[model samples]
Target: MKNSVFFVLVNILLCACGASANAPSEAEVFSSAHTTPNVLMIVIDDLGWSDVGYNQTTDLLETPNIDALAQQSLSFDNAYAGAANCAPSRAVLMSGQYGPRHGVYTVSPSARGNAKARKLIPIKNQRGLKTQVITMGEALKSAGYATGTFGKWHLGADPDKQGFDKNVAGSHQGMTFHYFSPYNLPNIKDGPKGEYLTDRLTTEVINWIKTPKDSPFFAYLPYYTVHTPLQAPEQVIEKYRKKGIKGEDAKYAAMVELMDTNVGRILTMLQAEGLSDDTLVIFTSDNGGYRTTSFPTPIRAGKGSYYEGGLRVPLLISWPGKIKPGLDHTPVINADFYPTLLTLGKAEQPNQALDGVDLTDLLLNQQAINSRDLFWHFPVYLQAHHARTDQGQDPLFRTRPGSAIRSGDWKLIQYFENNEFELYNLANDLAENNNLASQKPNKVAELKAKLKAWQQQTGADIPTELNPEYDADINQKMIDKILAKKTHH
Candidate 1:
């Protein structure tokens, strides 16, 4: 015997290298490196970043199924919105933390306009979302997944107390005074007699991704049909009034083409429950859109102005074959979707402080991002929604007690009541109409000491007294009658 055939061929080559190191690597079973993937997340309210058609900036906003899910998805041409409106931008996208680590900077009375036009006296606004902040639906339901959520849980009171095992209408009521039916929301129910509250929350999440689960969910829709009294469904408002689009911009482009046919029926029920390449989805928008029925054109003002049309919008993400479709501009926000869905759901990450940045290698290695410095702080006072077609910061407030910042391609802002700042350069002004803060005073003291050391590392709330019913001649006669009706439009 040749040494018993060399010990049985070295135990069959060590059990085939331990079964190829215990398999599972097609990008680690669709990323998170060992079987963890499924996180829908839609959002869409006050949509803009040029009302989606993959940003051809509006060939009259058709949004063919969110432009076919932004052409397979990776999209992110400078996304942003973690406070520019809608309940502190859904409480900084469910507390990855911002707005001074959760004071919720707006959508409650943080002195919103006319205490003789508020001069300072704000920092109070924490209307909800502070159950000790660990929610990206409770860290993806403690990482085994299977969560729910449906639509618009404007940061409080029953998103099943912030983790969402299932909370269909999702309350704290941000808007749904009537999308149809006595959608008298809260844990939702009534449907049948004139159904259609975004087609019954997209058939109740495609019957909860066709039930019968085995861990891996976190759905979260968040659509309140393109927000506000702009009804639709009269054959999709006569197909946007036959695309000649009329009034209220054809009922908000027929409620964004009926919420893009309920997002192509949950992308055909995640490809009939095969869970579309182990799912990842995303898509976005919680702010910016509602500047008199439609206008994010040239990014000037909308939603509740921190500008760049209320912090731009549309984000996409997809994850079909482990994230790779294309187009990435970087400037992300929305508290970077809770450490980018807890690093794609391999989860477990919340013992506080996560100001956002694990965009999962900017959505799986298209990575080049680098140039950071985002910050937005809104100390309060929002007002001006349609001040003669809102291009605010003038027509009597659309963000007054401020704080901005951008940093690479420089932005600046400031303004906690005329301690003023302004600067611009968003790579040749995306209509911030050039100020360059007195021609860049050392780039405005280097972005005002990096926006004052990020408002002293996010303790932020500095509105300094004053507002003893401050009038200043009725805020300069309503900012000179809305700058003479926005200079005759």
Candidate 2:
């Protein structure tokens, strides 16, 4: 886990400043047959439920290929991105716990990793995911799986440093600015000329699968599609433009169409390679799509906000001959994926704390979990670049820290710093437009206590150094390394 941060830091630095001029090559490929089942996790960025045809929106944005894939998948109707936004959500997703547990409560553009630097003023007071935490890749690798990550490696950036055997074209930046020929500031690998980013990523996956390996493979393809810069090929945009759409809506629609097409290509490769039946393909987005381009009408709030739209994301799992195809309102959170995958693959978990439950039995046996609570903590919203801020900030120019506790139909959203709260019965009100807290004071109190207890258990708090460590030793080492290289030249 400590090594994970180095990779993340490298990637973040690359995304923040561009890829390294001479970034190291991917590590040697490992065999995959020794592992139980190969896993392909396709995570789309900022995609909305309405964007996919399976979700049934009136917008008529067709996603035939994705829809077909979903038909055979265990669709999750109430899945959520662990956090309202990306980085923090990914921290939770990777650690199989809430962000607070990992000390990654929110996205930190300046998060650190080097130990020599850690000895100095310290790495920001903001909680970081400790090296002690376990990641899905590390766990699988320990179990003899070949893990490869392609596209958008935003959990600190360096996938190889984290645990991947092979990594191609991922960075800390949310999405590559150039779709056709993508490059990060840190490790710029130019894509084949005219090759779109989405198609290129899928191509890399297909190639990885073709590698002659004996161990099971874990391919984490976090697509940078349908996120931002909303650029698609002219042909794609024209395909929708000729259909009577224009401006922002048309561009957004084109991006969605392209995203679906690329996903289909991956599915086609799986079928062609005869790996579909043996592989477990999980498709989900990090968070809801941007509100301006996508509609989450039935669900209030969009990305960066605590409302359903920000956190609610589409989830589908397809393990042929394993999971039965159908919709399940079984309220499982992102953390559930951790244990669920381990259980499904029959892999051993490390001796450590894990917040996610294995939902494999639920998916395969049609069993119920009875009652389980899902939690989310967002300490701050710092410089949100991808999503829009709905209004001018409060007098403090910052949003307050907030936490949520959800069990069954009841959900309580609490803003800790401001002492504001909202409660909703999702079974009755999916939009979350009505605040039931005032009407259900007792329920609010009960949930507040639960949320507080969980916080105590997790021990999540902004450390004293988070505010003052701009020139911390870690960043200094990064600077010194850069300068030393220049002087040597």
Candidate 3:
């Protein structure tokens, strides 16, 4: 009997050992079938939905390279920037959180425009991202990836401290003082005399990619092209001039073409390096185009306003054979890229809560995510660039302190100053010409509740105190002067 018991114990031990040997390790479970994929994220400053050739919205500007990329990418038709301007939009992309969470509603002091024009005291803005916030660079670096940021890093003074292995010219400066060499920007030594900023940055990225490294890389190329100080190579400028595009229009066109050419260069480098198939390339804009230079028509307003033109931007994601090339109509925001990238890199989530959903299944298997409301809270004021042509609610300012919510086809904008609401069904009115707030009271109530709840949940500060300097008469005079100038022009 004792011998029989010994044999049974031996058999049980052998079975347990076999099971343990066959189990997959933790790393194996997290890894892909092949080595990890490299990520190349390109963010253009103030690039509009209608700017690219794929959209076919304008014939004045040419973007052959961007158009070609669109052909090989899963272009999103309803993609939005996290905010209507540069700093906040970039903050959202980096931290994967909404404006309320980071307190970066707009650039610098939120109380923009003349003191008399502002009705309420706007919420103060956070200049740069806090060190405590874990950026995409930090997350990807933790996952054993070599990270680099090549151009504009407007979030902070030093991207190196924010988790980047290499930061070329990233700084707190929003716009470049000079587009050519003797650029005089931080972290970038001046190149050859008369070297174009866009071209130089592209070369820097290509050189970085060529450097030998064991782990996969995350290359963030945020070009400061097509922003302000609308400058371009004289030759490119003359090319547009020859096409009969004159004035700032010609210069803007030249800048767009230059940016597109640099994009082509990057694509060529990726192909030459044999990294095309192994890399995931995402091209998008920080925000919508500026109204004074570029026209974001058929979708009212531009840049600072919360209209479709202000928030909407071109988004293209390409992973060669991994993701099928086609148009995706799903409404997505730039904040979504954070979780999506972390999942692709097989990285652990940060301790802080992320507002975006993981889009792995949607990208790889074409499985659509469940419908949910997207929110935007901007408790700040942005002065108008061109009050006459800006297509905003009013001519005085582009946007007042407000919060907006989009649920399915319905969208509602709530103004903090007057407690007014503007509701529109985006499916029917993409231009947002019609305000259906009074027409649909129930819909307004439904969306308002959700917006309020979101504000409460995120601890979004609303501007309530009336501005002490606000003058009704002065505000009217300013409006009249703007109108008269428009008429004179």
Model 2 lDDT vs. the true structure?
0.72
Give the Cα lDDT of each candidate.
0.81, 0.72, 0.89
The 10-residue segment of model 1 with minimum total lDDT is 26-35
Count of clashing residue pairs in every prediction: 0, 28, 0
**Winner by TM-score:** 3
**Pairs in clash, predicted candidate 3:** none
Encode model 1's per-residue lDDT on 1-489: one tens digit a residue. 222343355456656666566654434433433246788889888887788777855577777887887888888878889877888888888888888888887778878767887877877788878787878888889888889989888778887877888878887888886888877877788887777799889888889878988888889898887888888767878877787888788888888878887899899878776677778888888888878877877879888888788887888888675676778877889898888789778888889998878878757655575677989888878787678778776877788888998977778888888798888888889889888788769989988998899899888978888888888898899788768867877
Poorest 10 consecutive residues by lDDT, candidate 3: 25-34
Ranking by TM-score: 3, 2, 1
Give lDDT tens digits, candidate 3, residues 18-109: 65775543333323242467999999999878988888566988999999999999899999999999999999999999989998888898
C-alpha lDDT of residue 64 in model 2: 88
**Tens-digit per-residue lDDT, 1-489, candidate 2:** 222344466567657766556543232011112225689999888888667888965755878888999999989998988887677777777888877666665556333333232222222323344566778888888888899988877766576777688988755665677777744434446766777878777888888888989888999988888777878888878888888888877888888888888889888888887788678889998887776777776776566666787788889998765567889887777888888878766778867778888886677666677678888876553332222332112211123356788877998988643367889999889887688888999999999999989988987653233334334555456655655654676
- Please estimate how well model 3 matches the true structure, expressed as its whole-model Cα lDDT: 0.89
